[model samples]
Target: MPNAVEPPSASPTRLEEAYALLADASGAPWRPLAGGTDLMVQMTGGIGEPPERVLDIWAVNELRGIGVDADAIVIGALTTYTELRRSPVVAEFVPALVEAAATIGAAQIQNRGTLGGNVVNASPAGDTLPVLLALGAEMVLGSAHGERTVHADDFWPSYRTTARRDDELLVRVRIPLALGRQVRFRKIGTRRAQAISKVVMAIAWHSSADDGPWADVRLALGSVAATTVRARTTEAAIEGKRPTRQTADAAVEALTAELEPIDDVRSTADYRRLVAGRVLHRLIRDEGGW
Candidate 1:
């Protein structure tokens, strides 16, 4: 809000020529910029020490498209939260994405903030992260050389750090055809909407027989660990078991054991663990663990 970075050198075309120049340049330490939804605000608030040489990527047409690919629904890095929330393809293909998109920030923030920024920011409390993790999404990184894909599950190496190399720009998030096996996204914030999540969970899977098993169960949780994590143990416990009361209870137990939540300002470890159990119960018992 305070600082609208006056480009150290003006970009003639604002978007196209900037990337073209940066693309052709050698070892440019330019900060590729976007909608300025997150980055600008951070810089203004003194969270960012100073502005680096800026390379604007926000206005690139190639980085703003969202559609279904051969095997996945691809959301471009520059695609805003509001864009995703209103996208029919995303709604049909990855409904959980819509759910997460709707809760990102206020309308203004959602209008400017992008999916790529969210992924790269790597906040544990990030609303969409758990959903992306559960859906087994992949990120496509682009640069002068080419592109590479990394799975969301294994993307983050530490708190706020990802496998994304510095020079590479995140191009798009790819959600595979296996996404909709069964999906439910849940968030626990101070209020219904517009509040940062205390806990966010996304659980996806397929139910077996009438009361038999649940297979391909994937559970991703946020705001409880250094980074978002998969509830593997809980998922395995109920994957091939009957979806009865007993199995549901055991699933909660497994989930609790798998997490290592720390005390934070919004919630405590005990509270988060308890909420995790309850969320598992609701997801598995009532909604058929999808």
Candidate 2:
């Protein structure tokens, strides 16, 4: 007779109960499940073994809302892309995030995919990642021990990995308000819609004057590196320089030198590098009215 398969164990818990479960160190690890957008796909596709214990946090209401404080906009981890796209707070402050959220999958995927899941998944092609990097977002992680915050720049250290500990949950994200900054987001993919990104870029900057040096420039890109990376070299090339054809050229040069994309099924390294430079040039030229 064939050995009977043990069914997976799942526990639905509230926010406090979830924390308690995570705090207990002796038991088998419980995999946290929110929207399960990516996890379900992976599980059904046989990409990995199913978790023996699943911690269902969908009912953890404490992790589901958008609010604003004096210095930053707070977005709960479980907030869905649909909610992000429709959020008036997001629209007014970080419109690039709204644009990114709209590009995720279809409406159904957007409705079910949570922001925390996207960040935790740490996919280099994730749409919102570049935007978060450009905006200098901070993640609030919570566990039974306590809550601590980490900058988005320090969150993802490698491809498909994040700094989140096994015992902690990403509770919320805080985006510092940039009231007068110019922001832009662009995503290039194999198809016009509902496709994974080939190259994605987001940039934020404050102009010193109407047509002069740019300051506080934050340029970030995805699908061109192991992790979504801040294009610091490219940003340095543009910094304190007026938006011009020459500046754009220098930026392209620096960007080309900095990126080390891989030849993957979605795109080739050469093509991704070329597109990233082209996008940077266009962004600089558009901002300069050239």
Candidate 3:
């Protein structure tokens, strides 16, 4: 009898070759690794496991960098939380981006965990997501054939997953250059920094064209529904109308209806609903929605 060929072994060399082979062999599934923050935790705790080899792509330099273009800021997939948190551009131009980055676990987690990994992890509590949603960001996906640009709005087709194909890689995130948009980001956590948000909100909008009303509002929320959502009804209620207490109250009502909070260890569904709306109200009122 002919000798049976041995399956791929779980070695570093095998891990390195998996990507090269899978780039052509689409039939096999390959688990890509980086800091392995979430993956390692899941694997160690038996959250899940795979029979195939893992591709350690952390060393790929192409996936790491931060730069700004004429129309947008580009963040490479491998850019870590620490890099983003400490970036001056993040603080000056996208303060919400910095706020969100600062809240992703502790320093160690920030150093290793990457933005791409966070997006791929697909958690409702992912800190950067609400801001990205509000920013109208684009997700750039790549495969052997070429690259495809997907709006962040369209990328999350469902919970804990994105529109990334079986054979594609999430390469980078592109954020549109926003001007004079009074942005505000807030998170309610167990303590303060380095904690998962029970409630999080990011609002990007200008005060008004001529002190008339809220203009170009994009209010995104997290841990509210199945995925982070822009509060359209609330936005419509205030758009083109002078920012006032009455409008704020109406916006809160709209927000309450927009989100369908669920019960979880973090908080009660009812509490999440009330707080989510309140966060919107506060952000608009104090954080410059007008």
Candidate 4:
């Protein structure tokens, strides 16, 4: 007979209560449970026992809203993908994020999966990660002591690891508004709807006019490196250049050089590299009408 799984020792519904529990050093380390879309899966699938202490923050009102400040759109960590799809602000300023969010899962997963959970899970294949990296988003973490912000580029320093401290909660994400930039997001997976991506990418750029040169190009990719990475070399190569096939090919060369994809069950490193280039080429062609 199989052994029964153990339940979390404590479940706190309020933010303050959760913090106090985390601040207590005498107890076991508490894993903050947001939507449990990812954590629950890990726990059920893993060989070891589930976490002994879980801080359930699903009902914490402080972590569930979307607002706009002077320069950026502030999204509470608990904001669901469904909320993102419905948000006019997200549609207007960060449509790529909306696009990425729509591709996460079916309606049920979209309803329960929070943005914070995705960020904290820190999967290299996470769909929204490339969008966040391209948009230059910032993560806001909070603890009983205080709050500190980390840029998205620096958030994931290694594979499946984030800069978030054990005692800190990912409170929210702030995305700076890039009003007139042309943004694109694409995910190449085995199947369209619910499959993990082979290669996921997001690209954003500014241009003076419809036919002008690309400026301030920002390109980011997931499943191509240890962490979702901004393709700085590729961006630099494409910057100030018109979106032509030659330019796109050159950008791809630079991008291929920068990425270090590995062979996994989902895709081979060569296939990922090839698809990434193809996607970038198509994006450039479509954007330029070439």
Candidate 5:
């Protein structure tokens, strides 16, 4: 391995400056550095050659806070897992996200590992992706020209790949908040802490009241498919029904059919498939009693 040496980089304090630099250096082959939680490891020999230059936007104030509007919550791309776990806004609007964030790595990792890095890295086992997908999040991409929004479901079509343009940066994620909508997130890992998930599941539902029939529901899972994906068949099965053992059982069957699992270092395909169903069933029974 090469000696540990600093790579050439530029640190921009403002979002506009970062965008301008990217635009000015267009096609010059640079990588944007956010938290460096994943990139730093890769630099130490996880994969391909390190980038010749890195654009450091970690201190960009524009990409470091959470904001809310009437209909949605906007989480800046650089927001860390620790920040998410600590935010009262996140606690209220998307508590399940907090649950997911708590399961990623340890204290130091949570402090430096960013939600944007997680999204851009596009790991199939990324803990937050399933929750974001279930919450119907929207990704905002920024370039010198302007900003564009893409649905989270449409963002990742394959493993470790996304619709992000080379010249663009992921600025923030918008998570929708509707009345009476609740979400549940669960990560089934080999162990509770510092373990990569064997299977991860998130479910969101909306109804008229706490005990009302389900008006709509969205379900997503990770580590069981090419990319984090929706359990559309399972969602369709229980959309209008109240949570019941019978309904959950049928939904579990639907979910099993929807998943495409494969053996990996962390877990086996059969285990992931079977556990995914049980997790959904438990989530519905425990949180979806309405």
Candidate 6:
């Protein structure tokens, strides 16, 4: 009997081989498969039409680890949440990413879900999206032609859509380093774990002191609109300001104007807005010590 732990039958083991398979018209269209945490679920639930052919990239050794460059931490696309949560590089350089990874589904899902898959899935409520936005991460896409980079903010152009072409594969994610940066992450879900997030927020800022002037502020929130969006207006409103009730209020008001949340089964529009404001206020107060 075939070992149940092995990947699907007839999967390619090399990246170039997989790309070549995808380029072949004989298969018509081929979808790359890594962890299959999301795709398999969708296929099983009949959520969408299944692909004609699959290029299983699970055995592609090239896209399966985390490393560091001169000024950035690079994570392979197929690096699972479980791998990220335990990686020393992630823990030292991007703890927010680690925190985000830890909250995604449960242990099984974490072990089976790839970081690249999460980004490509393009769910507005994806736990790591907001963190990536705040950290100013970039996606490295590869194909038979060459490689291209896309900023996190620009990758998702619409609801459940991305700029990635069918022939391109997201090979890795790159996050630049920022010292003395404080990161805060929150996910409001029906349950603590194993539930899709209703609202996810990530805030990163550099401050010389706990309650002093701040700089390089970046705030991103998910499950609010068509995609995970940065609260630029709100960030500008409180940037460089000393922690205070007035700044908190201004931040909340600015966020209220920026977000365009909709009512869904998980949450109401009004509730989401109100909770977002509260969360922002709390984040500023707690982190800023106001």
TM-score winner among the candidates?
Answer: 4
lDDT against the true structure, per candidate, is 0.80, 0.89, 0.77, 0.88, 0.89, 0.87
**1-290 per-residue lDDT for model 3 (tens digits):** 22233224322333224335447564456666767888767655556544254556787778888999898889998899999988887677787888788888889999999999988777787778888988888999877667899997887778777888766777799988867676678888898756778888887777645345768888888887777777788778877766667777988888888778889988988998898877767765664344
- In candidate 3, clashing pairs total 1
Candidate 3, residue 75: lDDT? 91
TM-score of each: 0.89, 0.95, 0.88, 0.95, 0.95, 0.94
Clashing pairs in 2: none
How do the residues 1-290 of candidate 5 rate in per-residue lDDT, one tens digit apiece?
A: 74377678999998888888888754565689998988888887636667777899899979889989888999999999999999999999899999999999999999999999999999889999999999989999998999999999899989799999877899999998888888888999988889988999888888776656676788888899889999888899989988878788999999888888999898899999999999888877875554
Q: Show the colliding residue pairs in model 4.
A: none
lDDT, candidate 6, 1-290, per-residue tens: 22223223347778887777666666457777789998777766666656556677888888988999988999999999999999999998888889899999999999999999999999999999999999889999998888899999899999889889888889999998877887889988899789998889999889887788778889999999989999999999989897688889999999998888999999998889989999999988886565
- In model 1, the runs with Cα more than 4 Å from the true position are 1-28, 48-51, 208-212
Off by over 4 Å in 3: 1-19, 49-51, 208-212, 288-290
Instruction: List, residue by residue over 1-290, the lDDT tens digit for candidate 1.
Output: 45556545333234445545556546545666777766676777756445556666766777888888789888889899999988999898788889888987789989988998888878888888998899889999876667899999789878888997656778899988763277889888888767887789998776545455667888899999999888888888878776678888998889888888999889999999999889878766776444
Ranking by lDDT: 2, 5, 4, 6, 1, 3
In angstroms, the error of model 1 at 55 is: 2.4
How far residue 93's Cα lies from its native spot in candidate 4, in Å, is 0.8
Better of 2 and 3 by TM-score: 2
RMSD of each: 3.0, 2.5, 5.0, 1.7, 1.8, 3.6
Clash count in backbone of candidate 5: 0
Task: Give candidate 2 misplaced runs (Cα > 4 Å).
Answer: 1-13
